[model samples]
Target: MATVVPEESTASTEVKAHEVRPPRKPSASQIAAARSLPNNNEAVWPAFTTKLPSSLYIDEDRFDEEHRKLFMTLPLPLAPSALLAEPGSFVCRDGFGQSVILTRDKDGKVHALVNSCRHRGSRVTENDEPAKGRLMICPYHAWSYDLSGKLMAVPRREVFGELDKSELGMVKLPCVEKGGIIWVKMDHEANDDFSHVSDELVADFDALGVADMHMFALRKHEVEGNWKLILDTFLEGYHVIRLHVQTVGPLYEDTVVQVDRLGSHLRQTSARVGFTKDILAQNEESVDDLRRVVTYVYTLLPNVAFICSQDYCNMLVMQPKGVGKTIVHNFMLTNVNPQSEKLRQKWEKSLELTDGLAFPEDFSASAATYQGLTTGVVKELMIGGMEVAMEHYHEMIEEMVARA
Candidate 1:
């Protein structure tokens, strides 16, 4: 018994609805087209509303910009005690490209130097093990360098004929061992002292018991993505629900995490909503009686993550391989106490699981984003309120990139 509306009225209503359509979602090709637009610095604040040119991620010009702007003057780490595990054990690798060499002198003093030798640029040490005692011979030629990067001997030194032997030593970089970690400054003009960054990070570093930690898991990964993109994944907790759905998603709350800025350094911790206590109580028999019950996350200046739990810690260093690639060094550290085998194993396993899935997930996500960006498909990326830390990070990059 319902009456039908008039055809003319129905047609008029349909026409009005058709006239009002929501904004169209931009396609990948559309995004690329948007990149052709002019540079808009105004879009960099809360959201970098305008997508940068795809070339920024793949072009040689953009890579050169990053090299000159960011990597040209990076700080170098150098400290014998920081790199030492036992009385005289040490290890080191390249801060930027492919290079690493470890040496333990006869006096129980350890020196970690770059692989390249001073005499005609030959690699001094092999990749197998730390060279013992003083003499280290270069692989390319018979040139040799002493423990302190001194020109110990050169094949047919007399034939060189009046060449200054003193000046023909390996080029040493500015480095320091602090809080159980070797830090090398990459910039030649970098300040000799690291008191500024150290003083700020000392308390947190001590809290992790870094002074007594030993390296257990040392691994490096090469991936296709900007180093910052990989770093950004670790800097915030906003992506857990989306990116780490199966792994860390259940452990952290997307909205309740904390982010604190210490100068150029960043520190953060996730609230477990009583889950940490629950996990501890369930595994009380396996965990030690006197261990920290809280999970801590910290990021030191430049690029280092000190993720520590009650039993052990993980130290990660991310180095930019190129504009679109990065090299990551993941280290497992434990307490000096030899009796904590059970506790150490439990902690190490937790870190292993977390680190294990993280890189793979991030690699996939970052590579996909890079493809879209490089293909000229996206004009802008939109980050929301939960990703405030990420926005802050990008803002700082903009400022640094724009300076000078």
Candidate 2:
């Protein structure tokens, strides 16, 4: 149920029953950082002529380097924070072939731990679903750990001889909950922080009120395409008219969008036909008007894509598997009542539209492009100005990989 302010309230103070204050918009500097190049309505108009190397997308060596240089060193956005609402709640995640456990202990503090048990290195937790219990017991030996990753017990202490329980706790990873999502820097040896992720990104993250949202639905799908290619599909609105004609195209501008870059992250906001019409009619030229009336896609570098609408936040975490495949996790975060059939159905329609379009059209293009590139038929692909975000992304990848 949506919050409502009582009509009788005075101008000085009027609080809604369950209302929440909208999050701050991007700072002026942040906005300037994310601004994209100007583009014509054709959506395919020319801008910069930077050609991405064909091998960059399908090279096996490059894929392995990405795991080490990008995934391992970056502050990755995992699942949303809603999964940790309960004191003993936990969720497991698999990234870069490593298993991780994210838990909220009895103290209501969250911790990220490597899922492997200290004694035998067996996975102490499983992912793709939520789990809750006082102890996360290793199913192999009944060895257990507390939510904070503290060693609790070993079934037969005498059998262990002189082993120290304190020194054998689950390996804790450097993790923090930021922007309504859990972020972990995958370095097991270093005490790295998410400082490099930019305060601009985190400060602007809750713009859609994702911090208070609960998961409406979550799914994992493997697409037959390089992860970068899959992400490229979301960076531009050039294909909306021809590619998404039957679904979301008619509701949005035929061409034209603002693609901004905040550090390495890209925020692309497309003009909505219906909503844009209203703005033109009213002759309203507020600077923030475009943001208030369009769809926003924030591509968080290296992996996560945080898609935002006024009422919904769909976080897509693209986990690269091989040169030819990517594991995509779609997390639907919403404020709607989960138990209400009517509410859920309304929310589900949006997801259905995405699957219908992604599977048959948008994503298929990426997969096909990867196939073509692998065949050595193309030397490189040109990214135009309208798709400036794509160029920005490639450069960031190059810079990060080099820095590492």
Cα TM-score of candidate 2: 0.86
TM-score to true structure, per model = 0.72, 0.86
Candidate 2 Cα RMSD after full superposition onto the native fold (Å): 6.1
Model 1, poorest ten-residue lDDT window? 1-10
Stretches of candidate 1 exceeding 4 Å from the true structure: 1-59, 76-83, 87-92, 98-114, 128-131, 188-198, 275-294, 337-348, 402-404
TM-score of 1: 0.72
After aligning candidate 2 to the native by TM-score, how far in Å is the CA of 34 from where it should be?
Answer: 11
The residue pairs that clash in candidate 2, if any, are 34-260, 34-261
lDDT against true structure, model 2:
0.70
What's the distance in Å from true for residue 117, model 1? Answer: 2.1
